[model samples]
Target: MPASGQTAERNSHLKAVGFLIGGISSFQIGATVAKGLFPLFGPTGMVGLRVGLAALILLAIWRPTRSGITVQSLKLLLPYGASMAVMNFCFYVALTRLPLGIVVALEFTGPLTLALAGSRRWLDLCWALFVVLGLYLLLRPETMAAGTMHSFDLFGVAAALLSGCGWIVYILTGTRIGRMFDAGHATTLGMTTAGVLLLPWLIPVIPTAIMHPWQGGMAISVAVLSSAVPYILDMLAMRRLSPRDLGILLSMEPMLGAISGLILLHEALSVARWIGVLCIVIASAGNVLTRQKAIAH
Candidate 1:
């Protein structure tokens, strides 16, 4: 490439990195707010309201036309929406039972596993070790005994694992969906579909949640933080970033979750747990910088 083209490419890469970091930061801030709202509305109720409201917000922004809609799109989107809906619902449920930082750290394993698959590297082993160490620190028998300690709640843990799986699907599918639909339209329509699917549960709780006033505010706040802002920033960043780069950026979610929980929700991690978080952060950053250098070469 010519000097001018190389300079332009460097500038573009820098811009993409900035957007990715911004998106991750926005998402963490949103998580803090949503977690704070957990006392008012349970995670499931909060998720329903968030998705429902986000659909409306997206509709206003995207106004996706039905003209280009196709059977394939519907088929692809059905699972996508379903995964997204269930993911948020389960994650919030886990939040109700566990620390935000721990939940996010475990949740990250799904994507990290995806990142390392089929690629043999010493660093990949290191990443796995980091995750395992973090999980052990967070879920040690003694650690559970220290706090209110429902960390081992089988159902909640299952729900969180399911959410992590769902998120993995979401990331994989999002790339394809982005190719076919504009970000605003894709996210809004998909969320709307998920909201409608979830209405069956909402039927019983909607009236009570909304009428409660406090629950209603929490619901809306979750939608804005967990869905709206991060969704927008992610959409913008996705336009400029690759999946590996996006994954690397997303690895920051756990650290941000820890910090946000500590500062915003007054949740603190033990020294061991913080070290575990550091390991994961270093592994993730290493992967990103390594991949980036390879791309540059």
Candidate 2:
């Protein structure tokens, strides 16, 4: 490439990185606000509102037509959308019992596992061990004895695990959808599909909540911050950056979530828990870096 083109490319890459960072920060803030609204709307209700409103907003922005959409694309999108809906619902449910930081950290396991999969290197195994050790430290019996884990809810933990599983499915199915359509079209259709799938749960609660203006407003905010903004930003970033680079950037999300929880919800973690968070972040970053190196070879 020519010098001018190389410079332009570097600038665009930097701009995309900035957008990704902003998107992650905004997402954590949205999650903190959503947790506060759990009293007015249960987890499922909040999921309904977020997905429903997000679908409307994205559809308006994209104005996707069925002209190019094929039945095969629709097949890919259905499972992708369903995975998204289930992931969000389960994460919110876990949030009700656990602090925002812990839930986010636990949820990080999904992507970390994805990143580490198919690796045969001993170093990769070591990185995976760090993740396991970190999680153990974060949720171990000693932490509970110190009152640092008092809020631990077994059901919430299980729900978070389920959310992680959903996340893996979402990523796999979404990759296929991304290959089939542009991000805007794919996201709009997928979110709409998720909204439709969630109707049974949403229909029962949204009608009453819509009557009260305050509840409805909060729900709209959640949709914008959590779904619309982050998704758009992530898509932009993905266009400029390699998946390895994107994964490394995404590894910062758990730390950002922990900070947001502390500042917004006054949720504090013990020293041990902080160590645990650091371990997971390091392990994730290391895994991505290693994968990139392997690709270079």
Candidate 3:
């Protein structure tokens, strides 16, 4: 490529990296905001509002059409949408009882597992070991028994595990959908489907919950910050950057979530837990870098 072309490409790559960072930051901040509203809306109500409003906003913005969709596409989208709904619902439920950082770390296992499953490289195995060690440290029995331990809910942990399973489904299905439709169109449709799936649970609480204007504002904020902005940014970044680069950027999410939880909600991790989080971050970055190197070879 010519000098000018090379310079333009470098600039585009930097722009994508910036978008990815901004998107993840927005997501973590939105999560913190949602946690603060737990007393008013509860997990189910909050998930409902987040997904429902997000669907509306994306649909409005994207205005996706079904004109070119096939029966097979619809089949794929149905499960994809359901996965998204279950993932969000279970994640929020876990958040009600767990710290935001812990929940995010646990949820990340799904993608990490998927990455491991697809690679046989010895270096990948090493990264897997690091992840396992990190998880063990994060969830060790001694830590829970310590005087500093917050009340831990076993059910919340289980919900987080289930959310991880749902996340695996989301990742696999989303990859397929990305090939079939424009990002905005696919996301809009999938989100609408998720909102529809959650309606039965959401309808019951709407009548009894005391809805305040400030709460409504917060809900909209969550939709914008968490769903709309992140998805759009990811889409833009994907256009300019390799998936390997995107994966590396995304691996920082757990650390960011931990910091955001501490700053916004005053949820602090123990020293041991912080070490575990650092391990996971290192493992994730290592895995992505190793994969990229392997692909180049």
Candidate 4:
């Protein structure tokens, strides 16, 4: 490639990295706000607000038509939308019940599992060990006894794990959907469709809450942060960053979540949990660095 082309490529990669990081950070902030708002909205109610408003905004922007729908496309989108809805629902459920950092840490398992599965070299096992050790530190009973963990919080932790699993499925399915449709349109339509699907539960709750300015603000913030802004940036990044690089960069989310929670929500982490965060970061970083050359091919 020419020098100018190489420089442009580098710039694009940097933007993608930035977008991935920004989106993840916004997600964490959204989580912090939602957690704070949990008392007012309840888990499902909070999700309803976020998804509902996001749906409206995205619908106005993308206006995706179902013109491209086929058995193949529907198969992909169904799972994609389902994964997104379930992931949001479960994460909100977990957020309602547990601390933000713990929930995000546990949720890291989803992408980590995908990373482990895709690797072929023995070196990948080293990264796997780091993630496993991190999970152990985050989830183990011994780690909890130090005032950083609660027994009752385990249920939320499990739900977050389910969210992680759903996220992995969402990523996999979304990749296929991306081939068939514009990502912005697809995500917009998918999210709106998910909102419609959620109406039975949301309609009963959103009305009373929507009348409150504070609750409405929080919901809009969640929509902009978690859905609108990130989705837009992710679309830009997708053009520049390969999927593997995107995953690697996206793995930084847990650490960002922890830091954002600590800073914005006044949540604290014990030394062990901090160490767990480091381990996962190192593991996720390793996956990126090790796979870089391979993925570019």
lDDT tens readout by residue for model 4, 1-297: 999999988987898888777777877877787777777778888888888889999998888776888898877777888888888899999877766777787777787788789667888999999988998777665435566834437778889999999889987988788888877877876797678777766787767675788787877898888888888877777777876787677777788888887899887877787788878888888888878766667
Model 1 regions lying over 4 Å from their true place? 1-22, 143-152, 238-248, 295-297
Name the lDDT of candidate 2.
0.86
Ordered from best to worst lDDT, the candidate numbers read: 3, 2, 4, 1
Q: Model 1: per-residue lDDT, tens digit, 193-217? A: 8888877655556787767887676
TM of each candidate vs. truth: 0.83, 0.92, 0.93, 0.89
Model 3, 144: alpha-carbon shift in Å? 8.2
TM-score-wise, the better of 1 and 2 is 2
Model 3 ranges with Cα > 4 A deviation: 1-5, 143-151, 207-210
Model 4 ranges with Cα > 4 A deviation: 1-14, 118-120, 142-152, 242-245, 294-297
Tell me the lDDT of candidate 4.
0.80
Superposed Cα RMSD, model 1: 3.6
lDDT of 2 at 229: 87
- Between the candidate structures 1 and 4, which one is better when assessed by lDDT? 4
Choose 2 or 3, whichever is better by TM-score.
Answer: 3
Model 4 Cα RMSD, Å?
Answer: 2.7
lDDT of 3 at 3: 100
Query: Could you tell me how far off, in angstroms, the CA of residue 241 lies in candidate 4 after the best superposition?
Result: 3.3
The deviation in Å at residue 82 for candidate 1 is 1.1
Backbone clash count for every predicted candidate, in the order shown: 0, 0, 0, 0
Compose the digit string of candidate 3's lDDT tens values, residues 171-195.
8999999899988888898999999
Alpha-carbon lDDT of model 1:
0.74
